[model samples]
Target: MSGRQTSFLAQALQQGAGALRSRQFDLAERIAGDILKSNRTDRNAVLILAHALVGQDRAGEAIAPLERIARRSDDGEVETLLGALLCKSGRAADGIAQLRRTIARRPPYLPSFQELAGQLSKAGQLGEAISVIESGLALVPESVDLKVDLGRLLHESNEFAKALEVLTIARDAAPGRPDVLIELGRVLILSGDYTAAADAFRHVLAQRPDDGSVRAYLATCLLEQGERDAGEAALRAVMRGGPHLLGRAAFVMAASSHGRFFFDMSEATKFLGGKST
Candidate 1:
């Protein structure tokens, strides 16, 4: 390529990456398209375009470009990304084979296994995902991220008991980490142990006093246990402190249970300084 053309191509790639970071997938794809139009053989441009397509939920269109890069590169990251895109596009079997090949060649790259686990889970290959996660745990036994992911997957698969076990271990290992605590609390809630879930949420809140989600979860547990007044108080506190809290579902349940008139007219207005309808 000529010097000016090369410079333009590089600038296009940079702009595409910037757009991707900003979550402007359509713009990123357009820039990537321009780069590919000039040089279809540009592997980096193809990979960027494929990623943009995937981000835009156009995974089917991503397949060809990603496949081309995967075929030409031995990079495990590239293979894993391509496999993930393929699986997301509903080519589960092909994605699994590609991921397995990549893992077999590079076992130390834990993210590949993590991505494969997610794909397998989404494909309803729960057993396979669990097995892959277990193998990854054996390889990197101290990875808190992997353990948390496994616990979440187990919970989603309705293996609640196993989820609790994995999350408990992770919580014990990483005490005071809000992510671990929140996940453990969520699993406990899924298992219908509302009191335990509430306690876990409380523990997390003790560390992060401003966490509206934790407070809302605790309020939910209280409401579920028929502590209507306390639950309303907690929910009001959350709304007062974190007005933009995203746990409105929990608040709504608490509000409804306490009688909408008292919740909306009395507590909400007092705490939040606005009428609640």
Candidate 2:
């Protein structure tokens, strides 16, 4: 390629990346397609096209371009993305192998490992995902994100106590992080520690007063503790502040009441569409 052609390709690739970041997948793909039409082996064009395809949920079409790049480059990130795309496209075994190879060749890149762990978990390879994440944690023990991810995987596997332990550590490390607090609260609730869960939700509410989800969660904790009136008050407070909170609060109240009739006849009539006509 001439200097001008190379420069044009580079500019197109840069524009494509920007489009991808802004979620303009169609524009990104168009730019990538133009570049690829001229230089079929352009690595940047291939990578960008593959990413755009993945973003557009066309992972099947992304495979050929990704495989081309994977064959030509030793980039662990590329390998990881290809693995994830493969997994998303139902090629689980191939995806797992790609991720494993990338992890083996490269040092512990947290993002890659996290992606791999998620894909592995989805592929019913929970043991492998846990083992990989645990290994990564050994290398970066203080990483709150990694801890949270491992905790989430553990929680998904119904290891609620272990998830709680991990999330608690993450919350202590990043005391004011809303995400960590939320996850900690979730695990606490799952572990049947309603009181602590409520406390965690309250901590989050202190940091984010406008968070309707936290308010709803706190109300649930209250209801779970047999504080029906208090829970109802909290839910009412949430509903008053934001109408969107009403749906969530109603859901919590419904679940809490075990779908039983807790309302007066008039209120029940309203919910039952005016006595079922």
Candidate 3:
């Protein structure tokens, strides 16, 4: 391409990418289509077009553009994006196979494993999701991402003991990791070990003192263990916090008054279930 043409294409690419990021999917699609018309083989333009289509709730339309790039580019990003698109578009089995193939071809592949596990879990293939994450962990034993994801999946499947084991390993692997600690505390809470869970929550609070959710969790542990005064104090502190914290506090307050506070830690603390605004 001529200098001016290349410059123009680059500018178009930048604009399209920015538009996609800003959720101006229609504008992004227009720019990406223009770029692809000038150069059908432009991988980035194809990717942008695919993304815009998917953003616009036309994930079905994204397949062609993604496949076009995949046919010519051996890039991992293309494979991952294509596989995830396939999964989101209701071709989960094909997506799972492709993601597995990508992982097999390259050990410790991050995106493929993450995407495959998430899709499998969402599709109710709990065993497959666990297997995928286990395979990734085997390849990268120290990967906090793989371990945490596995733990959370185990938790979702109601395998609290197994989830606790995995999360403990992840916590030991990286003691300073807040997410691992949080999951660990949650599993402990669900396991009927309120004291141990409270200790874990305290450890996390030491790390992230301002986390109102964690504070609420600590309060729950204390309350369950018959420390009413301390729990109510902690909850009152949450009520005095910012908007999100106040919402959580209100949830707990209302749940307590309504006798709905008997839910297990997962149900009680889940932002989804309580959904405090």
Q: Which ten residues in a row have the lowest lDDT in candidate 3?
A: 268-277
Instruction: Please identify model 2 stretches exceeding 4 Å from their true place.
Output: 1-11, 38-44, 203-213, 226-230, 233-248, 257-277
Q: RMSD to the native, candidate 2?
A: 4.2
Candidate 3's displacement at residue 28, Å, is 2.6
Better of 1 and 3 by lDDT: 3
Q: Which should have the higher TM-score, number 1 or number 3? A: 3
Full-model lDDT for every candidate: 0.79, 0.81, 0.81
lDDT of 2: 0.81
* TM-score, one value per model: 0.73, 0.79, 0.75
Q: Is candidate 1 or candidate 2 better by TM-score?
A: 2
| lDDT preference between candidates 1 and 2, better one | 2
Q: Comparing candidate 2 with candidate 3, which one achieves the higher TM-score?
A: 2
Residue range 1-277, candidate 2, lDDT tens digits = 7899778777888999999999999999999999888677677788788888888889889888778878987877678888888888888889888888887764666777888899888768888788888988888898898998999888888888899889988988998788888888888887778899999899999988878788888988998898988887777777666554545766787787423243564463344223222
* Ten contiguous residues minimizing lDDT sum, candidate 2: 268-277
Error of 3 at 209 (Å): 8.0
Residue 176 displacement (Å), model 2:
2.4
C-alpha lDDT (0 to 100) for residue 77 of candidate 1: 76
The most accurate candidate by TM-score is 2
Worst 10-residue lDDT window, candidate 1: 256-265
